[model samples]
Target: MGAWVTRALRNFNVENRAERELSKMKPLSAPRHPSTKSLLQEQMSRHPEIEGEIARKDDKLLSLLRDVYVNSKDPVSLKVKDAGVLQESKEFRLPIGHHFEMMNIKSIPKGKISIVEALTLLNNHKLYPETWTAKKIAEEYQLELKDVNSLLKYFVTYEVKVFPAKDKKALQPK
Candidate 1:
């Protein structure tokens, strides 16, 4: 019995040592993908307006991508207020696919958090913070306002209380 326990402890130590050694090595990125700097440059070229927006919000967008997106297994979304104007801008259109060799991404992936999920994340008080607005979530995640509005309306109809009663009723289903 004592030999078995000793062997188990030795195995655990070996595993821990292997993990530490692996941690010391540089992390591997997605295969066939451009480096972080190049990817940001490509994204900037695709969305010219986005050039200063990310930097203005979080200095040096590269760090944001590396620290937030690259390391994350799941998608990362932002929730800045007043993002509709940016999305509605003419610069945010689909890229011209006629003359591109490795830039097939027409639209960025936006993370979706259900109304129930959002509500669960927020305080139950009637006076929810302004940051919890659907518009803010849509902006942060680069989602369409119409889609977000429709989702909010649908959830509200189902009697989910993410927003104030008056606000919920006021939200157009379009």
Candidate 2:
């Protein structure tokens, strides 16, 4: 009986140790790729000429963001004008002030998006207008007009529809 009990205890200990070892060996969830540094390295490798371009673009973007946050009036306020809201409307119906979701603007993937590209998308897409002209928008939101203008221009030039309806006289051919 003593021999049998000792053997059973030894077996149990071995089984538990094996289980712990296997647990440690179990595959971990695929590790997320470290994207940022790798992307910079890839860019430098494949397109060395673009390093300067990347830096310039980054400067402009940073400046614009800074201006919008620093110089605008409301800085953090969010609002919409009725006509402007129409700019983001689709032929189908959308809630009065929820159009910005059309282009997934909040999550634009990191890449070289031109102003025309952004404007075309935001204008033609089902965006909910959250900003007026930069000056007005800046005043209301406390963002700098330069930054807001850059962002707005990107949307305005490409997606003319995203712009608020021009007043009748303003619409007259200049």
The segments of candidate 2 whose C-alpha lies over 4 angstroms from its true place after superposition are 1-131, 157-174
TM-score, one value per model = 0.21, 0.17
Candidate 2 local Cα displacement, residue 89, angstroms: 37
> lDDT per residue, candidate 1, 100-153, as tens digits?
345555553245543433454233212463665767656654567787666556
- Top lDDT: which candidate number? 1
Candidate 2, residues 1-174: lDDT per residue as tens digits?
Answer: 999999898888787898889879667667557877687687689988886775565667788887774544753334556556765562332222345556545422222333434454345333545444446544543446686666665544422344555676555433
Q: Give the TM-score of candidate 1.
A: 0.21
In every candidate, how many clashes are there?
A: 1, 21
Candidate 2 has a TM-score of 0.17
Q: Write down the worst ten-residue block by lDDT for model 1.
A: 117-126
